[model samples]
Target: MFGRSKPLELNVLVLRDADVIATALRTALAAAAPEERPGLERAAALVEQAAAVPDAALRARWVHERLTAAGHEGPVDSVRAVKTLRESVPGLGLLSAVQLTKDAAAHRP
Candidate 1:
């Protein structure tokens, strides 16, 4: 007898690795419209190297510019920051969840 295939499920855990997240984000960013892609690509590449905590924060702060350059910063431009983060992460913890990255960095696990 033929066996049934299992349904696919995507986990929604918040990732914390810049490299790993950037790889996944690059794919999502490619889904944007043609005109609004270049900036996203730039952000993706830059984001890929945001291994440093400060770089990650800087990227998040200027995420709008990066997306705008890509040609997709629209009415809800703020979303760009959220989207950028969704794609690339620096690490997760009470510190990051509450913007205490510097403190967390100072105190390594």
Candidate 2:
């Protein structure tokens, strides 16, 4: 006879709005230890500030800043930049990552 096994259950919380994320962070902050409170508070504030910006704009800015900081600009190491973009920005399509990488390369000083 085969042994009985428990069914697997999954719970998922999707945070589509920045306000929702900030509220969750705030809730976590109330119970966070002294050492962890600062990080949670800062995350909540950042989410609130970013709430006004569209997600696409935020992703673009982050990609630009990361590529620039990594010195992957001006067509140099562009392949790596694409990889970095895809890795840093989850769910970013490959074509979009390539385009952003190319655009960054073109705008390099």
Candidate 3:
């Protein structure tokens, strides 16, 4: 009689929380001004596209660009938004990005 075979298992990796991000984006869209809603929606699309990439750096860059572009009015609002987003996402790059924005705003005339 042959010995019993052992069962095999596979491991899976989670990249990002798309649902959480989507919910956050929806909240942002709802809170946005009528004129700003379009831009915010566009930014959300950029984030969704970035999520497809497996590399963290690339994803961070995409997020950074969208946030930077959306930050046209004031640094304080931008900083707050970035901080809130960082909390939801959780990453060093995001922290640095928010810090850099704050630093730039501080030095501006």
State the local distance difference test value for candidate 2.
0.66
Better model by TM-score: candidate 1 vs candidate 2: 2
Cα lDDT, model 1, residue 32 = 82
User: lDDT per residue, candidate 1, 1-109, as tens digits?
Assistant: 4899555432223345788778777777868888878878887877756655454444334433434455553432234434443344444232233233222223332
Which one wins by lDDT: 2 or 3? 2
Question: Residues 3-95, candidate 2, lDDT per residue (tens digit)?
Answer: 996554322122358877887898899999999988888898788787876544554555678766765555533677788767766776667
lDDT of each residue in 1-109, candidate 3, tens digit only: 5999654431223367765787799899999999989988987897788576654444444444545555534343275656654554455355455654454444432
Cα error of candidate 3 at position 87, Å: 32
Candidate lDDT (C-alpha), each: 0.48, 0.66, 0.58
Model 2 regions lying over 4 Å from their true place: 1-17, 24-47, 75-94, 102-109
Strongest candidate by lDDT: 2
Superior candidate under TM-score, 1 versus 3: 3
TM-score of each: 0.29, 0.37, 0.35
Comparison by lDDT, 1 against 3, better one: 3
Give residue 105's error in model 2 in angstroms.
9.0
- RMSD of model 2 against the true structure: 12.9
Ranking by lDDT: 2, 3, 1
